[model samples]
Target: MTATVHTLQANRAPSLEPMMALTTSGMNAVNAVILDRMQSKVALIPELAGHLIAGGGKRMRPMLTLASAALFDYPGTRHHKLAAAVEFIHTATLLHDDVVDGSGLRRGRRTANIIWGNPSSVLVGDFLFSRAFELMVEDGSLKVLKILSSASAIIAEGEVDQLTAQRRIDTDEDHYLQIIAAKTAALFAAACRIAPVVAEAGEEAEDALDTYGRNLGIAFQLVDDAIDYSSDSATMGKGVGDDFRDGKMTLPVILAYARGTDGDRDFWRSAISGDRVADEDLARAIDLVRSTGALADTLERARIYARRAVDSLGSFPAGKAKSAMIEAAEFAVARAY
Candidate 1:
């Protein structure tokens, strides 16, 4: 009769510094590709794209690509362009997401959509997507192209599905899982999957990395959802109550709703329906999630997925790359702590 403990001590928490250090040189190359390709005759495209691209994102997707490639000890630079393409795709999605979410802040800075207006943000997002495709094509790998292109389409479909589910209290945990798998995990899978393709590491390695990325992505989003209720805007890099105000059916809200009293449910209904967005409602919402153990449980769920992600790398040789990747997963789940 063993209990699963998911929380990390503050002094003993995992960090991304190892992964960042491992991919430093490769990421420099990818960043160059990103900057050069983002240039366009239309000034507005570069301006809007640069705003979010240069924003303080962790660039985790592209970093995964580079680190996965390093797992194979890949000597060539073929992954640099592909990793840049992954970042372009990710950045484009963020731009469009800010517009769709009507968000005001990201990475503790003003979102491009808020600063440049929605139309400009959306069109610039399209431009970045086009640039991503161009990079993918220039790489001349049909397999890589297929993987990333399909991921892009799946991400779009997921976004639409999430839009349909938005503001709907009936959205369950399984349904929410499906939406995040597509919207978030799809790209993550592709990013790590492309690494094996470029390294000629065969399908088995590709599958393993895909599993790692997909599970890590799910865990990452779970912590983010939990953080929305447990953390502040400065800590989360966006408005703290943005999800509640947007009526996002994240796991915390879902779990809390499922476990809540009738009165609590009524309060959630009102809060999620856009009727109660004041500070007190947010405080009450936080209280409900905490009292119901929804936040703690969400972090626990993230820990499970993070462990799966780490276990998926068992086939790979143990080295710095493997250690860094494992630490990265730990870091993902530990962020909420």
Candidate 2:
């Protein structure tokens, strides 16, 4: 388990750091408001839903929503509602994911499923999903509903594909990209895109934000896959090799398999494909990924996406908000550390 990202420091933000601190300060305020909104409803489903709220997550979805709104000169209360909406949608997914994965630990703590059980988690997830729909209807906009609904559908499709594709071990870059775009990038795209519509940025501006979010989300997933094979369990908050153990093939593993030697390929096929693995298999998998230089190459690909995210900011004017977005993209990649 290594935490070093070769490209993590490539983007140096002179003022972006301070602006990020400000963004985070604002994030805390928004978190409180959103948490309050959640509390009003969690009492009915506390065992499953409350644990998810108290659980640790980066809250990146709402950060994108608020930051995008701020960038478009939105100085109104609507952004708060939208931010909370993004959170509700994201939290709902986490609840469902834990149930689907049968995960016992999240953020180094017991998952809602482990504490309360799967049915509770699933029902509470349904509750949050319905709550998000209710909030979206309050906005009275069809476009918002369309984007979020599409994202939710894509997320579900991604989960289904992952279930079917489990441990195929032949999962290629295309399949890996598709699954992640559907699973992770869909929410990120929605979060960044809805702001332009809420702020009434022109169609062109809205499209740019959508592209930015999609690319940034892809980059984030790439680093996450790298971390699965590289980072220690302590920092990752879940088992280091859970991806393989759970039969989910990601970019790093796919690339490593392609470039590995005969012995490397055999070890992975037998040990990883079979489910139960020794520590030596984990070590060998790490070595195989490193031996093929896949980690460095994949990290470079992630860097390109981060650059694309910054480049998309060309559609926005100069402001602290835009700077924070650039910083957020960089920070996403740096999170590998």
Q: TM-score: which candidate is best?
A: 1
Check candidate 2 and list the clashing pairs: none
Count clashes in each candidate, considering only residues at least 3 apart in sequence or on different chains.
0, 0
What's the lDDT of the predicted structure labeled candidate 1? 0.92
lDDT of 2 by residue, 86-129 (tens): 78888888888888888888878889888888887888788778
Give residue 146's lDDT in candidate 2 (0 to 100): 96
Least accurate stretch of 10 residues (summed lDDT) in model 2?
A: 1-10
Instruction: Report the poorest 10 consecutive residues by lDDT, candidate 1.
Output: 1-10
Segments in model 2 whose C-alpha atoms lie over 4 Å from true places: 1-20, 24-29, 39-44
Candidate 1: segments with Cα more than 4 A from true spot: 1-11
The TM-scores of all predictions, comma-separated, are 0.96, 0.90
